[model samples]
Target: MARLNFVLLIAVVFSALYLVRTQYESRRLYVELEKASAQSRKLTTEKERLQVEKRAEATPLKIEKLARDRLQMRTTTPAITQYVEYKTAPAVQKASHE
Candidate 1:
């Protein structure tokens, strides 16, 4: 009878320890999940902000101004246009061998 009681006590202790370990692991995972959610929210806000800035920077007037200022480009005009002619070389005739 005493040996049976001892075995039962050991089982109970092991079960209690396992429950505590499981609870600790659950809490740790919950904390990590919360952190990841917060990070996701932060990344979403940043993406929205960058999108707004992109829209502002890509306005047609802004693009035209940047093209004119950064690159020396101008609209085509008849005054600056020139015409060129193409000439082909005459073909050479080979002498017949006797």
Candidate 2:
């Protein structure tokens, strides 16, 4: 009867240790989950800020300024315009039909 009592005591100790390990693992996983959620929130906020900057950068006046300053471009005026004319040869058209 003492041997049976000793076995039961050992079993209880093992059960308590197992419960402690399970609780530790659960708490660790919860901490990791919270960290990941916080990181996601930070990244989302950064993305929104970048999107706002992108929108501001895409305004037409800024594009025009960038074009004029960076690309040395200007609005078209007839004084600086050139015209082109296209005339297809009759010989080339006849060959394509064959």
Candidate 3:
């Protein structure tokens, strides 16, 4: 009877320890999940901010300014325009044998 009681006690102790370990792991994983969610939110906000900045940077006026300033481009004018002519061989008229 004493041996049976000892065995039962050991089993109960092991079960309690297993339950505690499980709870601890669950809490740890929950904390990690919260951290990951927070990071995700932060990254999403950063992405939105970057997208706004990108749109602002890509405006047409800004592009034109950059082109003129950085690339030394100039607007086209009729004074500087050139015309090109393309010449092709005259078509050969085939003699028709009646």
Of 2 and 3, the candidate ranking higher by lDDT: 3
Please provide, for model 1 over 1-52, each residue's C-alpha lDDT reduced to its tens digit, 9 standing for 90 to 100: 9999999999999999999999999999999999999999999999999999
The window of 10 residues in a row where model 2 has the poorest summed lDDT is: 89-98
Please, what are the lDDT tens digits per residue for candidate 2 over residues 11-76? 999999999999999999999999999999999999999999999999999999999999999999
Give the count of colliding residue pairs in each prediction.
0, 0, 0
The model with the greatest lDDT is 3
- Report model 3's TM-score to 2 decimal places: 0.81
**lDDT, residue 51, model 1:** 100
Which runs of model 1 end up more than 4 angstroms from their true locations?
81-98
Q: In model 2, state the lDDT of residue 39.
A: 100
- lDDT of all predictions: 0.95, 0.97, 0.99
TM-score, each model?
0.75, 0.82, 0.81
